[model samples]
Target: MEVNQNDHSYNPGDIVYVFYRNPHTQDVANVQSAAVVNNPENPGELAIFLYETYYPLTNDMAVYQSEAEAMEVYEQYFSFE
Candidate 1:
């Protein structure tokens, strides 16, 4: 499925959070902050460079608009509240 880039509120060079399912943990996800490295000409395809891992992630992942938004997601799902 092609994602409408316009619908997603993120721009290149913007710092965004990406979500990935933790392979070591069951039923848990990990969040990482990365910079929007590139948005391919093909609509909906985005690449991000992660600072923590020093690698570029191009797989299908959820990208948040801002750190605050990512925090909200983590709090709602990952937090033990």
Candidate 2:
């Protein structure tokens, strides 16, 4: 299936960067490389595959096309110190 989420400017196989908060540590977060893919369970929707998990890809998500871009935003808003 060749699908493109034009609204989000991303499609299956697209590499994106996102902020991943450690599930065990509530305060620690890091930039992670993720892949955009068709959601197997949802069929028509897109999802972000990272760290062995699939997260729903929504318009509100802070997805970045490059690691540098992701890091910039991360430091600006998510960084504690």
Candidate 3:
């Protein structure tokens, strides 16, 4: 498993994009949401609550293959401002 190397940079209420792997099919879901818990006890990570509950983001859910992947999805859907 890849480990996060950067410092936690987001906070609760900040919108972020989480690229997750679907539990059933291993499909990628690049979704956006508000950060719920940034760097919980895990460090260099975050917990997000998806805007769409039909696809709830879980702690066990795989969020991005790497930081670069996450950033790519964020750039695709979210504004830098």
Candidate 4:
């Protein structure tokens, strides 16, 4: 199945940065390099195939369109750190 590259926030295999928090420790992390795996369910949703954490990367995670956005989102939502 051919996927529309622009349909989602991130395309499969595209190198992108994600801002997230550790589910267990609640430690916030920002600008983490990750590759978009697939959007098996939703068009704009994405799955991160690789990351530093053991937690499964889900579509609900805060994915930024750009590195600048990552910084902003991190501070806005997860700046407790």
Candidate 5:
């Protein structure tokens, strides 16, 4: 999908949080911070800069503006007590 400036709510340089699943520990997940940046591969598009990689911003991503927000959702579905 093509991304325009108006296509997403976040601006470049904005910090965003996301649930990151550990590669080796497939069952483990944690809330991690990522930076919103203009897609270097696709001009005018937005992507999440994390783990030294650029991931295109898509509708399926549950991106959060705050760590608390991310943790809240993470707990809702992933927490077991």
Candidate 6:
């Protein structure tokens, strides 16, 4: 599928949350990061790379299925209420 780069529907710098399970612990890791890239291959999807010390921990790369999924995970970790 071809990604429409001209589509202003979504921006690349938007903040979003993501929920992911750690392969080792089977624990859910919710993380938030800026939207890095969006294209046809990953349409309706967002990529969040693990940062150094403060963010999620990972050596390989990870991407969420959708924005809602990312937000849900982010809320799980950051939201108190």
Give the number of the best model, judged by TM-score: 5
Whole-structure CA lDDT of model 5: 0.85
- For model 6, residues 16-80, the per-residue Cα lDDT tens digits are 33455565777555454544444334455533343422232222333354677657657766576
For each of the candidates, the C-alpha root-mean-square deviation to the true structure, in angstroms, is 5.4, 2.3, 9.5, 5.3, 3.3, 9.3
Worst 10 residues of 2 by lDDT: 1-10
TM-score for each of the candidates: 0.53, 0.85, 0.35, 0.53, 0.87, 0.32
**Candidate 4 ranges with C-alpha deviation above 4 Å:** 1-9, 38-46, 52-59
lDDT of each: 0.62, 0.85, 0.49, 0.57, 0.85, 0.45
**Candidate 3, superposed: residue stretches over 4 Å from native:** 1-8, 38-46, 50-81
Give the lowest summed-lDDT range of ten residues in model 6. 1-10
| Per-residue alpha-carbon lDDT of candidate 3 for residues 14-70, written as tens digits (9 for 90 to 100) | 554565546677645544344445444555555565543323334445455345767
Report the alpha-carbon TM-score of model 2 versus the true structure: 0.85
Q: How well is each residue in 1-81 modelled by candidate 1, as lDDT tens digits?
A: 333342575546677786766767878777777777554544455456664443333334667776788878878888886
Query: Candidate 6: which pairs clash?
Result: 17-70, 18-70
Candidates, ranked, lDDT: 5, 2, 1, 4, 3, 6
lDDT of 4 by residue, 4-58 (tens): 3334444566766676556676764547767666555554555665543332345
Q: What tens-digit string does per-residue lDDT give for candidate 5 at 1-67? A: 2333324478788888999999999899999999999899988888999999999988788888789
Where model 6 places Cα greater than 4 Å from the true spot, the runs are 1-9, 38-81
> lDDT of candidate 3?
0.49
Backbone clash numbers for all candidates listed = 0, 0, 0, 0, 0, 2
Q: lDDT at 18 for candidate 2?
A: 93
Pairs that clash in candidate 1 = none
lDDT of 4: 0.57
